[model samples]
Target: MESDSETHSGEDTTPDDWMDLAVDSPDGSPAASPAATQKPSEEEDFKLSLITWNVDGLDLEKRPERSRGLVKYLNLHNPDVVFLQELVPPYVQFLKEQLVNYLMIEGGRNGCFTGMLLKKSRVKLVESEMVAFPTTKMRRNLLVAQVIVNGQKLCLMTSHFESCKENTAERLKQLHVVKRRLKHAPDDVTIVFGGDTNLRDAEVTKVGLPATVCDVWERLGKQEHCRYTWDTSANNNKTFPFVARCRFDRIYLRPAIKRGIPRLAPDHMALVGLEKLDCGRYTSDHWGIYCTFSAE
Candidate 1:
């Protein structure tokens, strides 16, 4: 990874300051094949499988052998891309070695690292970056990637915003900064944002994402199975012991075309990683959300 470029300010930086990056496609493959750049035919396959998780700050010092189990758990799901928050640098290095099928890209600071892993053959990483917002004396970031996924250009990002309940304003600030930062991204690609926003749905919308975006869980009619993404009493990687559950973790999307909106597949939540171990510790404090999107 290149040394991350950064700027500190209480106000917006020019669109050019958003840290747009260019990286070779995974394994020296061309960034976009000829077939990939062509106009999509109705027959073109634009399906994407994604997973986003917060490992509760898993790092080498915190849990040295945890990457082994995480690799096993993540591989089982067969995700095309995995977005992770709070995965420290050292553990990321370890997973890069173990999860040979996926390549790692990460960002963030103050121990709130965000990472994204893409299954090498399914997607080509065209660009990757970390957009930071220095607020409340701590820096938060939005980890982003521009990729060619199965012939469709897509921009996917995940974030870990301000955490405490009292820092709602700070969270709102971080939220607005990221929304503005993405305005300069490639205009024609599908965009997907997911991960722990650390804010509830209502609070999230208050930050005002473009009207085109919709929370995938709610857009799919807030199905019964995924009604609650965060819960204290029932989940394995427990946090906020007394905090009642809310849909804190979520996935949001903006379709590629005005009319050809991708339809989300059924069975979006894959909570298997939350299963307990022999010692009764859960795989992670929160369950990962998995969804398949098909370009119509």
Candidate 2:
């Protein structure tokens, strides 16, 4: 993985600057909103929408404007749950101010870390905790949130695994930790994990997801349009002489196995942040993955 100095040379503030602001609520309670009062009928099928993105908070150029663009996209999509990686303190503050209808949970307070946003109206947070990687050189860790959506339990997990092609071993170890969590989760709770995994296809094949789990992109027929999340050729936010494309950002789903709970199926998948902002830069160096699941 690239060191902090190498990847985030533009960063001006120290980690201590945002330590106090990073405290999460005791119960992860979200403020009441108008939408919270409206409940769906029991007979109606429930749909869950999610978005996962690496917001590239390290880059300080056009930072404020870029954050506005992110808010615009989030408002436009209005996902029920969101998994965000590469989050810095300032970016988290900006999101809290703009996204008033979401409950924000930080994975770590210092440096760049991961976070989860649960919509105030649709999702109810039960608890949240972070699992640290024992040998992570980049301070990477897993952020897990237990949430309730329409009375059904869901385990939401997000992480920014060790990056760089050279750190494949470390990335694999991190992947194992995630898989173990999924395998041990209660059978009645569905598991949904998404983030910038920084994994290669071969590595996933080697570790292999649980039998109940399925890669959202692969389960949806691997549509070419949204296949590559980290495509330098398409996103020009970072200047590079050579073009590169990789599916670094991904989502995995493991539906509840116990009977009674409705199974969530992957229904739609698409990429966001494709358009350039007014400042002539994309939302981030990597595209965001948007997906919808229908309870069956």
Candidate 3:
């Protein structure tokens, strides 16, 4: 692991400045970054599983079908915490019913609230708050929960970053809010941040964070791999939809190491059209990224 001090050795000394990091693909291979000469030991212990997904519209009535599917999926994996994006209050109420024993906390503005539904018997929500940014038009909020999972304290953050286009400096400033929040979190707590970042390949350069926190997907090292969170069938490799395959939804973990966990989604849900353009049929434009870690 590269230290924050080491990563900052090069130029780009601006506060929000970030180096162009070459990340890995989904297949546990190196992509934009140089391949590692040696791999880590497989016997390393201490694991936890995390799932990040955008439940599309989260329509209270029609989308409960998707909610039902999601509940069942969680029951199977039973992650310590689930980071969800785009869940409206009504849908949260519906999910509350479906997930009878779980405690729910929501943050952010209307359309982009981030939520965490924790199994009541398994975890306890100790503290939480919203990340307010002065420069942002719509305050991008983060729901942070201090949870006790199997006798362990895990800090889970549900975040939805800014999306509307603007100058690189502004975007970087917004991203700094995310970084500063994570950096300021209690050092003793085991922290994990996940959600829809709305970042394209080019925008990845703007994110700045301590080395203790890493983009899980970037650790894999195979950047060119067929890894895209959104479907861009209509756009011709342009601004909005950068490439044929684009992954805007992201999950960033602190204290948890990268171990490839299978991507599990609602059983019946499928993308009928482009991932982003909801055509009134498909559940969501983005697919879920599921990763597992050992609790022991």
Candidate 4:
């Protein structure tokens, strides 16, 4: 975890917002042939660099030029997939222009949208859908997509849960709904579902479905690794410095079968997009985070 994560700014703005490749021989080669197609290495089998960010749509409205920096950051970091919340038209349009190689699947309307940006050059999109939680007034939505990479099917679901501590029940219900949905995904695919949960340790711990989903941050033994995503102390966002700072953004993995559990390489995990512009302003109110996942 970065010490700069000491205090994330902007509370409950919930609605507001990989690995090296090993080339395998294409020929139907055998391991012994030394020239035939070889089995995909674990890194090649499940390699993924995933990011989740809540871009504080409201903040972007004030400083829209930041979009350029956002685009530049994405290009520089270049994660394979990005989960975004509180997306606005300009930002979406900017991404379309800048991230021309990505397949952007957006959900919801202008005010509060959620979506995923999959790198078309890296993964093949097989299917997709969007989901809405029934019990919340916040009108959050989840974006789902299935992509094939290196012949492995991965179910990717990103969501923005109910916002504010007041909607704790709704968030919990949403988690249960997500857990139940993931619990039934076809066994042939690896499941990963997460986004702006608007949740803290208190409620998240209760969202127990160990056999299904596990917080990858915890798997790395860095529970507070995500603390600065929405910290008040880190930036000059509207929130007062004393306001509580916690990470509302997250990414989790659900092992479809015991055989497909993951091994998270620590080097690829960290909070990103926190760099200050030459003008000393942040790229966004939220700091993006990403991790590399490979089958164990």
Candidate 5:
């Protein structure tokens, strides 16, 4: 658990100004593979990266330039897939136009905004749907998509949750619903689930994902310099507005994908994963995560 000193720093923000992968193998049979239980390779061959961000109240009236910058930043990574929360409809179209190569899809009511973007060059969507929250039921929708990455079948889940500390239970229920929907999915197909979890340690443990799940940030350990993911430079450690942010947005992969191709894929040498994009230049209330993977 982070100490109050850590919590009070305003590293993680909600709403308002606070705000906000991969490779190729080939198409295969629908049958599930034993991929989930496979071990991590001595050396990772494929590279894939993912970013989960909660754009703070994005709309036509809001930060259009920042929004446009975000689209460019995402394009920089050319992420195999991107999960975003707090998306307004117009902003969604804006991103799709800019990310013309991406197959864009979103859900969670018309206003709540949660969606996923897949690079057109890598994957095609086979199916998609939404899971709405209990309280905001129709207000916040969970968007799930099955995509073919590097020729392997994969699942991407994106979402935003009801605000406030008390909504934690409802949020957990939402996560479970997401799991249940994918229960029948082949364990071999890689699963990347993330969005604005709206949770610190207080709520994560309660969700209790199956043993197969792994949060990339936590798995990477706390000693790393870019650990935090929420907040701006004013809130950062003071070097850069985007530096020293907290970890809020995230990318969690199932055992299969993590083992098949576990590497940080980035455009920047500092953000090495896959693709060639610079990350430090762009500033956002939330930072992004990118990891690359390959099929076995």
Candidate 6:
């Protein structure tokens, strides 16, 4: 559990806020070959890939295998940035030992919290900070990081949000804080926020996003295949008796509005961690979201 000293009081705001394992390759497919670095021609555009997931770190059972499963996905996707939720000390430690290629920024020092992993070769870290959710009963906070990726200034944010259907009000408050931060960010920085939001479609509609920001999944046309990220009927990892499906995990992009700063647009989106691990358990109750962006 987190000590009180670790949590900051929430601030009043409108419209703002803000893993690994083991075993075999889940899809029985070979790991993706790394893309060779090439200097982009004038006609070529810079590309960025990101993944966000809730690894269920608090479960404590079969964690090593589950952590290994996460590693496999990281290897497979080789994303430039990763947003993680529900991360505990041991789980974060394992990832640190395994993923030497990433520069990790943790939201909290102890207990379950959120984190960010920036690929060392591609992302140059600028700064990071955490914004506490003032009324959260779950100790939720927003983690934000500023980095330079391929000469583009990018702001990355992540959070677990307030959980459960009953906590909608607090969740929306947290969402507003996130929106304010996004709305206030510098015009030259493109921002990407992702995590286990624990949000329903209706709740998002109630708060509304900023004019410049768009949900990555929706921007990519909201394909049906990747719509439900927390489908109990298919995942079966939580062993809930009743069937339920929801898109609790999501990613949102706010492109830079400044002139001459290349704008990044969503190019592709997919869900990850669909297959069961060698231990016969899925990587998480929620499927991870993988997305690609092209700066044009």
- Model 2 lDDT tens row, 12-62: 343343333332335654223334345645543288999999999999877
lDDT value, residue 142 of candidate 4: 63
- The list of candidate 6 runs beyond 4 A from truth reads 1-45
Error of 1 at 154 (Å): 0.7
Per-residue lDDT of 1-296 in model 3, one digit per residue for the tens? 11011101112121211111112246743221111122223332134556777776534333544554555455555554677888665555555544555566766325546677765645677776665545655456566677766555677876666665564455567567667766776555566777777776576664657776767667544344325666555432123525456676666656533344222211111122233222233345566766655532
TM-score of each: 0.77, 0.87, 0.65, 0.79, 0.67, 0.87
Of the two candidates 3 and 4, the one with more favorable TM-score, higher being better, is 4
| Alpha-carbon deviation at 96 in model 1, angstroms | 0.8
Q: Which candidate do you rate higher for lDDT, 2 or 4?
A: 2
Clashing pairs in 1: 237-285
User: Candidates' lDDT values, in order?
Assistant: 0.65, 0.84, 0.54, 0.66, 0.55, 0.82
Clashes of 1: 1
Evaluated at residue 288, the lDDT of candidate 2 is 96
C-alpha-based local distance difference test score of model 3: 0.54
lDDT per residue for candidate 4 within 1-296, as digits (tens), equals 11110111122222222001111126632111131123435564557778788777667443444555566666666667888887765566556544656777777545667767887656788877666576668777567788877667788888888888788988899888778777888776777776888888888778776575677776677656565578777766565737667777776776556455443333356887777765467767878787777655
Cα error, candidate 1, residue 273 (Å):
2.1
In model 2, the clashing pairs are: none
Q: Candidate 4 — number of clashing residue pairs?
A: 10
For model 4, which pairs clash?
7-231, 8-230, 8-231, 8-232, 9-230, 9-231, 9-232, 17-54, 29-36, 29-37
lDDT of 5 by residue, 1-296 (tens): 11011101111222333222111124532211123223324342255556667765443333555565566566555556777777765566556544556667756334546667776655678887665555664366567787766556677887776555677677677667766644555756777777776666656676666666666666655436545555554332124533444456655666453345432223221122212223323334555555555432
| Candidate numbers, best lDDT first, in rank order | 2, 6, 4, 1, 5, 3
